[model samples]
Target chain A: MSPPNALDSARAFVVDDEEAVRESIALLLRSVGIASRCFADARTFMADYHPDDPGCLVLDVRMPRMSGLELQDELNRRGWTLPLIFITGHGDVSMAVEAMQAGAFDFLQKPFKDDDLIRRVQKALEHDRAQRQQRRGLTELQHRYDSLTPREREIAERLVAGESNKVVAIDLGLSERTIELHRAHVMEKMVARGLAQLVQMILQLRGSSRGDR
Target chain B: MSIPPLAPDENPLPAPPAESARTNFASEDRLSALLDAAVDPIVLIDSAGRILRFSRAAERLFGYGSDEVLGRNVKLLMPQAYAQDHDQYIHRYQQTGTPRIIGIGREVTAQRKDGSTFPIDLSVGEFRSGAEQGFVGILRDISERKRQEQELLRSTAELRLIFDNAPTAMSITDIRGHILDANHACQVLLGYQRDDLLQRRYTDLTVDEDRAALVADFLSLNAVDDSFSREVRFRTPDGGVLYALLYAGVVCDIEQRSLLMIVGLIDRSALFAATREADELRDRLVHAGRLGMLGEMVSGIAHEVNQPLTAIANYANAGRRLLQNGLTDAAELVSILDKIGSQADRAGQVIRSLRSLTRKREQLRERLDCNALIEDVSRLMELDLRANGLRLQLKLSPALPPVHGDAVQIQQVVLNLIRNAAEAMQERRGDEFVRVTSSARARAVVEICVSDSGPGLSAEVEDRLFEPFLTTKAEGMGLGLSICKSIVSAHGGELLYRRGERGGAEFVLRLPTATE
Candidate 1:
């Protein structure tokens, strides 16, 4: 049995120049109850691919016209976060290393055991699902934060920095009663259950924004 | 010179006293003395064919004494054949008054006293002592001159035999290249009869392209010892071309004057063909060896094979999973099994192609699409190029004419050039590319150019780029380009190199299109 959250709509995308290889990978994924699509080359896969799709890409590293690494670069440039699983053939260690450095989920040498490929694909799908959820959560949090009044946002930033309610009210040169009211509004808008939860959400937003570059 | 007056007993004919008185004894004695003193052996015969007077030199020449044959028939001095006809000839001459030997000198065979035969010059004169009309025949021994003439004739006959029977084709031509004489070999080699060949000028048989040079060589044969030899092409009457080594020399007289041009031709057509065939075989072997030695090619082939194997493995494992889980119907399982089978076949196909590529085989030529060849080579090199972080761009012209050449050999040449281009750009960073282009050139020629985006060749390396044993790579035998060049040339094509527009080395291979 697969994980409920990861496999509900998870699909495997197999891209290889070889028709048999591409078809067989799709077949293997299908046998494992995972839905799949096959593409004869990276360019075709890119043409039909959507950034919002919940899937893991099983890519052959040595396709003609456009190789797997090049496709990875294109995906990165478009700011798509689809997880990539590279299938390297013989003597493709250097390419595999390069793919890994470019944020690939994993790589498998050709003729690898079916279980190894299935396991990697499942893991890549789980990772992709988790990443999408995190991104959605961050977007929602930003929307909540965007809805805040400017004065309330300033008070929330200081409180999340571990300043006391009294200290935050002084730094803003406002009444403690005024700061307390603004904190309540901040927590309500961000949908935080408590002060600790509010602190974690704001920190996560700051870290993710820095990583966006 | 002294005269020994013949005693009465030794005289062949006794002079009558009345005739002797009419001619005086002093005059007779002086005439006898003059005849005896002559260096040439002479004998006097009468009209009856009997000997009348014998000089002393004649005695030493014929080995006879006058005392022994004072009245013997002159037939005794002739060979059997001449002796039998002498008497009749004399009688015929006397009756008809036809001067056979009279006032005419002839060479006739004479015999010595013992039995040896020798040649003589004979002349007869009619003399009258009284009422008798007698013929006085004078003869001279000419054996030494005759022996010299026979010697000259024998040597000339031997020289003629050697010249006519020599194995090499030979001809004697005037300075204008007009053939005066051609030997049997020359006639056979040219596919012409001896008389027909003799009627042709040496330039006529020469291939039209070579005729001017041959004429120039002939005109320069002014010195008595002038001679030259070179490889030339000759056209036969049947329109076949013959490769030959031609040697021309001037034949001179003893006075060192140029007389005739003696030309010799050794047919080298078969030898030239054999050499070309051997060169082709050698190139094929080297090509196979180079393919084997190419590390990048081996890795690429391995990757190609692995792709299929991986597919097969995936299918086999998938089939097992479906069967175990009962997750597929029989039809679906069968389809998966079929996929597995074809994948194995795919892997086997890759191996078979690799085996054929590296196998030492006879050079086989057929009409081939150059675009197809370039595409095949590009497929083979895909992984290698990717591994090096390089891109290959193919700009193949569609509807290209087919070129005639060995498929394997041509593929090898294309692969070598691509590999060389890849290596040249291997060290360069950023946007490295190797471009392969195929297009039809003028005159029914197909051109394939392999160029890279790396540094072009150095001047020193470019000078000897195609020379064997010249290598920039440490592991290279430096025979790749040379062998490729030979293979292209053997196919009646050309391989050229130049700096590409991208400022990298470019090799252009042009092969003639196959004519239907």
Candidate 2:
């Protein structure tokens, strides 16, 4: 049985020049209880698409005014986050390779089974939601972490480095009791349950810095 | 006798003792007159190397007065380059007295007063007179004879050069049609050793079927004209047939009556190949054009069909899920819908791929990765490869950079190369392999090598492999490699071939990389 909250039931966009492909993909999305918008081509889709909405895009690889890949590049350039599923007629493996390398969610050849396409779209949507949530959590973490005073940051860094209150106090040229109060504030601000959790959060923040770049 | 009677001043009789002196004076006068009247330039030189007497002709020839030349050494008349050798030559001649370049007659260069040298025929005579011994040298200028000899040598050398290197095949035969001379080209063209063809009759070399016709043609031409021109086939020593246009003519050679035939080969094999290639390319272009037109016509049908296919699939899936939940009402409809949906989509996909392959837009030239293109085309042709029971071995270098080319077009070239290699090895007795490999070469070039275990190209066809529409296959149009060459050249690359290490024909394509 299909899950009720399967991302196939999420909002979606169908972008294509062919009328039948556009209408059919929209119908398919509706059958899965997903709200979808249809446009004739990339230009029409771009003109009407709302950045605030969280949805996946079903784009034709080849289009008249703008190609689907070029649209993906432009969206990326504008920092707009959306999962992309390419539907190709002449699906060369090279193009598929390139699309995946460029971070496309999935690529489906023409005349693909509706279930296969729907399943891929559903997977892409799920992935997109998880990424969005991760980004939100990261942003919230960064905001809270950035609000810490320099002294509190020093204490947090020292605690994460496995230094005791006495070592951190000596390193920062502060009192041991003052270091203890700052460590408590670091844990509270980062929403950690304990010193171990706080250290884990600090390590996670450092690890994510490498991945984001 | 009557003038002797005059007795005043002319006939005054002297005393008897003075009579001998008068006779001596008369003899000296006679000798001088004889030397002056000679036609050859004569010079009389004493043993001390002094010019005692020089005739009027000698004075004119040596550019000097008799008085000035009388006491000078002969060295004064020789130019500086010849002067150093004159003394040695004179000494040698004097010592040997064997007439090395003197005595009876000899040809040598003599220099006049102005320092210009001319060929001269000289004869030196040795004689002993009463109180001194002297040499009488007779000289004749022969500049014109020397010029004629030089001109003859130059023309002979030029003729020999032409005879050796002429591109047309030439054979010299005797009056009886026996081959007497075969140039290098003629030997190679007829596939015969020089010794084998020598003394062989021309009729023996002609194809047996055409010998009668050739003989008739030759005789008819000889009857009307001195030369005969006819197209005939010649049998090679190795049993191969070669087409040649033979032009034979009768000529009287110095030693024998001979016939010289200059054969010009029209080389129609390459031409016929090119023509076939052009025809095939035209067909392919027409096929592509028709495909494009057909695509436009069928796209509407394709869309209409795709819609129902998608609907059927969706309905079938929904029914399948519903039946999994223990609902049997929609189960029968599901299998029927699945079958229809699968077939419709399959048809739609075939149409889609066909249209895309032969789309209206011409292939655009750009920098592309050959490995990527090969992978794409191979995937598209996977079904064909499998159906043919062929295996494709790809050895692509991972770090291969992009080569300057049209990706789609080069993919077509690679496809043709691989397909031809596979087809060539279709019925090979042993293990068959169609190996495709790519490597970077010369720092800025990429090479794609395609080799197969097919029967290698014949020496004959290998030379004209890229000529259009020449195929060994029964159903081939033969435009594959010709179009491939055009594509390669359009991208500033070269396609080449040879017999593979594994006993098959190998084709290698070299393309310039983007940086190159």
- Best-fitting candidate, measured by TM-score? 1
Off by over 4 Å in 1: A1-213, B1-26, B126-138, B254-258, B282-296, B301-516
The lDDT of model 1 is 0.80
TM-score of every model versus the real structure = 0.42, 0.41
lDDT of 1 by residue, B18-110 (tens): 333324334688877887898866665544555567788889988999766545677787777667766666656655666655676677777
Give candidate 2 regions above 4 Å deviation: A5-9, A50-52, A146-150, A169-182, A210-213, B1-516
Name every residue pair that clashes in candidate 1: none
What DockQ does each prediction reach against the true complex? Answer: 0.35, 0.06
* Model 2 C-alpha lDDT per residue in residues B1-516, reported as the tens digit of each score: 000000111111232222232233346678778878888787765443445567888788878887676555555555566656654554554555555533456776777777777778777766554434545677777788888889888888887667656776677776566778777777778888889989887677889898997677555543213777767778887787777767777665655444444333433445556878899767756644443343243334444454455545555554555455444455555554655566567656755664454343345657788888777656545566667777778899999978876665677777778878878877857567788899888868999998887888999899889985477865454546776787688778999998999678899999989964
Error of 1 at B55 (Å): 0.9
The superposed Cα distance between candidate 1 and the true structure at residue B405, in angstroms, equals 18
